[model samples]
Target: MKINYLELKRVTAMHAHEIQQAVNHVVNSGWYLQGEAVGTFEAEYAKYCGAQHCVGCANGLDALTLTFRTLITLGRMGEGDEVIVPANTYIASILSVTENRLTPVLVEPRLNTFQIDDRLIEQAITPRTRAILVVNLYGRNALTDTIIRLCTKYNLQLVIDNAQGHGLSLPHGTLHSAALPSPSVVCHSFYPGKNLGALGDGGAITTDDETLATLFRTIANYGSSRKYVFDYCGRNSRLDEIQAAVLSVKLKYLDADNALRRNAAQRLIGEVSNPLITMPSAEYCHDNVFHIFPVLVKSPDTLQRHLQDHGIGTMRHYPIPPHQQACYQAWAALHLPITEQIHREEVSIPCNQTLTTEELTHIIFAMNSYDK
Candidate 1:
């Protein structure tokens, strides 16, 4: 039985009829850009995320860049200010920071959770630090009490890159309360493969601050708050109409789909007992939506080849650490042991709402059967 890593075609087919109808409506309406569809989706998504406002954008990277840029415009942060980010995260996260001329202070993630180590954040904090940008990598909740407390103690802005964590609820009680400040914002990506995906590239920012929300919307729309009125030097990054309508349909099922992903991840965590394979801690399994079911092995390439031989496909969440990339050669001398180790050993298995029971069982069998 051949099982692909993630079959987006199969996933889309689950609601193809509704998606088609939504697209047809847009095509016939003679409106495509900023229209009623985008407005409606922004409202629905804002409610779903429990935020007061949502600003749709062109893509995830734009969502992140716009948020930081808005903060700078508000005089809350500025160029040369530092933003703490996870060292093991995708390059896009760091790029958003550097794009605005803000310095990115890379902190290593804990090997166990594959998230930024909160314990190390405070020590990395210097007087120049103005924000804490926590990435919810692999759909895990990166927000912790320590991280929140540090932000509060130091009066730093809080930014969340929820590109992979669409349906993950903020932890209950204090963790949730502490996670949001007046300047706090959550950035989302509705890429084709995400839990809350659209047919094409899409993204949004959720924030309770009305001022910031309005500013983000303006900056994403060619820096125009009104027609022929240019407030800030912005670029065109609107979400468009068709993608918004499609996202509205998918948004209804996001919670249910996330539950399915969690169920599959739980099965893998409970059943896989290979000594060489290190599964994520079961305690935090439910805390994530399981966008990517990752495991650590000494030889990821060998395991990948073994899985491929068995007609099972796998991928690496990331093969190279951002610090080691050629673009950031200036930081090549920085030694990040844990971040480097995760990049070396991590392999992403096929886990999503599209997997069948039989396919999951086969994946389990293949993983347990690996001896090399």
Candidate 2:
């Protein structure tokens, strides 16, 4: 009874027939790039997310970079501007800001929720601060009401790094807009392992701002607003027809799959009563799609070895903090205790939609038995 960290094969098997049909349809269409499939998926996804527009891109990182570059093109932001981001987020979130020549102000995340501490946001804002990029880490919603108010008060752009948080919704009041209930620009990933994955790498940006949407679309397509008419010196980042077709089929089932993940996480939280392990609160579970069920333990390496001994696979969402990475040598001396602690102790367990009752119980038992 080997329980893999994520049974991607099983995930594809669940919708094999439909996925194949969609792939076949794209293959037979004779039109690949900038085709109908991509257009259709963009519209459907925008409607699903309650956004006015969606621009599909090559991958999650591209989606993020394009959003910032597009904003720069629109004169909403400029190079060297500061963008506040969580110090605990994946490197991609910080990379996007730096790639656009913007400064990334790393703020600490709250230990309990693994989200940015909104209380610390205003303190970090300087006159050069132009935006805030909140990553909904591990599929949890970081779109807090206080963050919304702060953005409005500061006249800053609100960008969402939603790569791991597909199908994650927030309460109505948490968002400012009644129509969309999301940020001005939200980026998504479909990197074969995400909650809403495609067959290959894929991503999109959702926004209600028409100007930004149009700019992103133009910028993603080699900066061409029309054929051979280059706009703002962009790159080739369009979401190909094949991945778009695959995503369209999978998007329909995202919510249902997320529900299963939530249930599995609840089971782990309820049954695993080990004193050494600290699970995220069930109260905030509903706001998360459980892309990764991370448990904080004193000895992550020892626990990972124990799970492997039991034929139970696991992973670390991130083992190194971004500030400590070799690439960011200048930030090596910066101290972010909470982020460093999370990186040291966090271990991601199997909590996908395909886990069975017996498999979940086996996990709980193994976890409870780990003392070191």
Candidate 3:
């Protein structure tokens, strides 16, 4: 009855046949990069999100990197450019800003939501402020609407990093925080684990603006619309046809799959009555797609070990915040209380869409068995 912390295959089983067919079609056609599959997937995904356009890239990291790169190409983010980022996000979001030589200002997360503490954002802004990078954390909408308003008021470019929040949305529509920014760049990662995960690494950039979309495509393909021409100093990164096809099949059932994850999360929330463990808050945002079912315990390390001993695996969402990581220790002069607090307490339980009734009960029993 052992359950692993996270299993990627449960949701993917649905699209196995269609993905194989799409791959076979690509192999026979011999046109892999920038072909019909990639184009169709991008178009379909964009339409699904209610956006005007989508540009496919090699990986999710590049999606963010390229988004910033496009901003650099447009003369938006330069050496002195300051980009505000939440301290609780994944490192890729921070890398994109730093790789472009822009200064990244870390902000704390809100107490309950684990989202960027909007109160701190205005204080972090400076004369060099260029943009605000809003991340959709925990597969829930995290202060995106508020961030957009702040960006607008502050005259900053609203960059949307939607790596974990695919298929998530706001009250307005299907787009996951896409409508907020004027020259906004929404980046998604299909890293075989996300709601819209590809077979391997894949990502995309979304924008309603035509010029930015055109620029992103060129930047991702070694700065050339026509091969080997070298329009700008770009690198080679393009989504292959195989992964695109797989993503398309997965995309069709993303919402339904998310609903299943949510159902699983609800089951855990209902049965677990332990006083020491704080259950994950149910989201009000309809766009919420449960990527991780994390609960806060008094001691994360002790609880993780306890679950493992009971044949139920658990993991910490993040052991360290971005600023506290070894590489980013140089920026340790600044302090962020809330982000650091989240790192110490959060633990993701064994949650996957495929867990059967028996497996789920086992998982619950394992967690409930852990003592203070």
Candidate of highest lDDT: 1
Model 2 lDDT per residue over 1-372, tens place: 799999899999989999999999989988999999999999999888877788999999999998999888888889899999999989999989989999999999989889999989999999999898999999998878788887888888999999999987778722224633234799998899999998889999988888889888988888889997996677899899999998999999998999999999999998999889998876557689999999999889899999998889999979999999997898999999999999989999999988999999999999999988
User: How many steric clashes does model 2 contain?
Assistant: 0
Instruction: State the lDDT of candidate 1 residue by residue for 64-129, as single tens digits.
Output: 999999999999998999999999998989999999999999999998899999989999999999
Candidate 1: residue 367 lDDT (0-100): 88
| lDDT (tens digit, per residue) of candidate 3 on 1-372 | 678776666556667788778789989999988889998999999988877889999998999988888988888767868999988988999998888888898888875677787778888999899998888887777745667787888889888788988878767676634456687778899988777788899999888878989999998888998855888988888889999988888888887887778777778888887877877765423356767776787799888888878778777778888887888879777677788888878998866677788888877887777786
Which regions in candidate 3 have their CA more than 4 angstroms from the true location?
176-179, 283-286
Task: Evaluate model 2: give its lDDT.
Answer: 0.89
> Can you give the lDDT of residue 260 in candidate 1?
89
Worst 10 residues of 3 by lDDT: 281-290
lDDT of 3 at 338: 80
Q: Which is the winner by lDDT between candidate 1 and candidate 3? A: 1
The true-versus-predicted C-alpha distance at residue 185 of model 3, in Å, is: 1.4
Q: Candidates ranked by TM-score, best first?
A: 1, 2, 3
CA RMSD of each candidate after superposition: 1.3, 1.6, 1.8
TM-score, candidate number 3:
0.95
